[model samples]
Target: MSGNIAKHVFVMAGTGSIGLIAIFMVDLLNFFYISALKNPSYTAAVAFAGSLGFILSAISIGSSIGISATVSRLIGAKKRGKARRYAATFLAVMLCIATLLAALNFIFSRQLVSLIGGKGEALEGAVLFLRILAPAFPLLCLVMAISGLLRSLGEANAAMRVTLSGAVCAAVLDPIFIFGLDLGLTGAALGTIFSRILICANGWYQLSKHDILAFPRLKEIKPALKAIAPIALPAIATNLATPVGNLFVTRTMSHFGNDAISALSVIERSVPICFAFIFALTGSIGPIIAQNFGARIFERVKETYRWALRFTLGCVALIWLIFFLNQNLLIKLFHIQGIGIPIIHFFCDYLVEGYAFLGLLFVSNTAFNNLGFAFYSTFFNWGRATLGTIPFVLIGFYWGPEGILTGMTAGMALFGTLAYFKAKNVIHNLHLRFPEALA
Candidate 1:
């Protein structure tokens, strides 16, 4: 049992390392432009636009979640053919959804930015960015489906490579387009689209090579859609909560001027970089748990949860220490000036501690989803978004930018604690009822 868990972690971590490097490299490149521009309002605009894109792109992942859950179960039941069918179905669904989303992005780019409280040059930049990236939504969705498919098959390394390839491509292109070509914001968006196309193509090649991915026949589509919809909707909703909550946070930050909004953007982008391992652990273990659960190996399911939480929290601690010890150097790396600097400082100093609890929340969400308690994860997250975020953010509004971070920390602490206990109880009850199934 120990050996298996260790192996899964190792694979997951290896993928996680590559993914982290890729994500940070892309984000850092974007920030390099922001820093080089040395304009707070411009930074805020880019961040706001980026946030809109980020939130919308997340739904594609929701589709992948449903696909992953289905694939894991099929694999656990030793139903390889059915698993591949779902993979085909996933591509079909993602393509359809991505088309609609991309159209919306193009049509309502201005309104989308406006709704997010973007205005002036910031709004203009956001509209340009979204429009430029709009067409790639389908490609992005397909990439997500492929990655989730690979992870379900216990091919985290392959999935990581696909993601890394995109990241490396984006990082390489970002500088050339943004600076070499002097395309400015459009360059950034184009860079992103090109990289995503690369990822999608690579993913398709792998899936086709494995004979696992295909365009579904009309007949195969309905049943596959039926199976995925139930899981996908709630899973999507669960994924939506954070970004929805972030919308509120971003809107709140907007009132504090471009500096505050830009600072929040910087931190948001920086998170995946700093806590990539935690994110990787959360994703990597979901399939492991789901496979065990599907096979009725309740003990292994429970063990994965405990080990994952421990491993994730440990990563958070180590990251926190690193961030704390070198906070000054890290701050300088962003080349931020004026208000953004102080805001960044406050985050590194005090709010950074909250990440441990956030790690707990992430692991708990994965556990719930993999354990067939998708609604529970959804409820907990949306509950946090509303009951947890609104009140704390309101309270923090009184203290300015630093206070917002405090409010965020408070909300996550409360919700994260509750989620941990709820998941613990759920796991305990499962073991109690299925004691004889502990194979």
Candidate 2:
């Protein structure tokens, strides 16, 4: 756990440099060209194209998550040999899926972008970028899942190295491709794909270093699939909402006009900075809880949950304050505003101000999501987005988008608190007896 703690933090902090800076990398290159992809049409095109990419990334992420969850479960059962076999199966399956998708993208890039309403040069660019970017899906998916398996076995340091290497690769390649090769958006996409391929290779090599490499026996595949079914499959589908929701938000803002969309884009990109740490913290906690819970170590599970909440909320608050203090300069940096700052600043403030509660929501959902509660996590997240967020967004039309932000703050806060208490009841009945907790 301590190794997981230290290593996950290091890699995530480094990934933040590239992941958080990605939009800027695109925007900066665009700014240099200024004519390549900065117009309203281009903005729309990028938004739509990127949204599709986001959806793809989400699917990949969810698959990785499921892999991590499944592999961790196997590790918890002291089935290292079995875990390795399942890892191989997952690896093989994901490689095929990613390869097929890349082929489809190559065959139908224009159609995929157009189906999502991408237009003009944007559509043309989207085609080039998507085809170039398609192979990354498999690489990222396979590596993330494999890394989870490694982390599951307490090889956090090695897993971190793989994730970090991907980030470093991206950071180094972004400037080189965009500036040196002049590939523009396609360059950014290419850099990302190549980086993931490298990461996948690194992840594979790391696994080969495992004390005992166990090959999956064809015989046990069925039972392994059955055990994994509860965690892996639904996760693949349910995690689609992230990119979907972002698309909805992007489309809604776009309807307001270009400035609205651009401002929202910058704001969305920036908010992830605050979330990066929170994400890392909750994510780090998930596997610990997942493994310990599977083994019925109730006290460790409970302690980890409590400690995660404390650490995450505090981390969220600290970063939220930084965003608050620098709001003016930060808002100005995007250079995309037209009287949107007040609204945008309010959105940021209200969004982060409500972090404690939302962090509660995040931790709870992650707890369930990590521990084979996929349905609950999915339902709550979708519900929160639909029932909780939509109502506020509707109200925003009447009051202002800031009204929507307020509503978001309120909704996330309320839902998070309610979810924590709700989960508490189940937590009580989690079928574990911690004699240590009794003592």
Best by TM-score: 1
Off-target runs (Cα >4 Å) in candidate 2 are 1-46, 73-80, 102-127, 211-224, 287-303, 337-343, 369-374, 398-410, 428-439
By summed lDDT, which 10 consecutive residues of candidate 2 come out lowest? Answer: 26-35
| Cα error of candidate 1 at position 321, Å | 2.2
TM-score of each: 0.91, 0.78
For each candidate in the order shown, give its overall lDDT on alpha carbons: 0.79, 0.64
Model 1 poorest 10 in a row by lDDT = 19-28
Model 1 steric clash pairs = none
Model 2, CA-based lDDT? 0.64
Candidate 1 residues lying further than 4 Å off, grouped into runs, are 1-11, 20-25, 75-85, 287-303, 435-439
Query: In candidate 1, how many Å is residue 19 off?
Result: 2.7
Backbone collisions counted per model: 0, 0
The residue-by-residue lDDT of candidate 2 on 204-283, one tens digit each, is 78877774346556675576567665666677666675556565555455446555655555565555555666656666
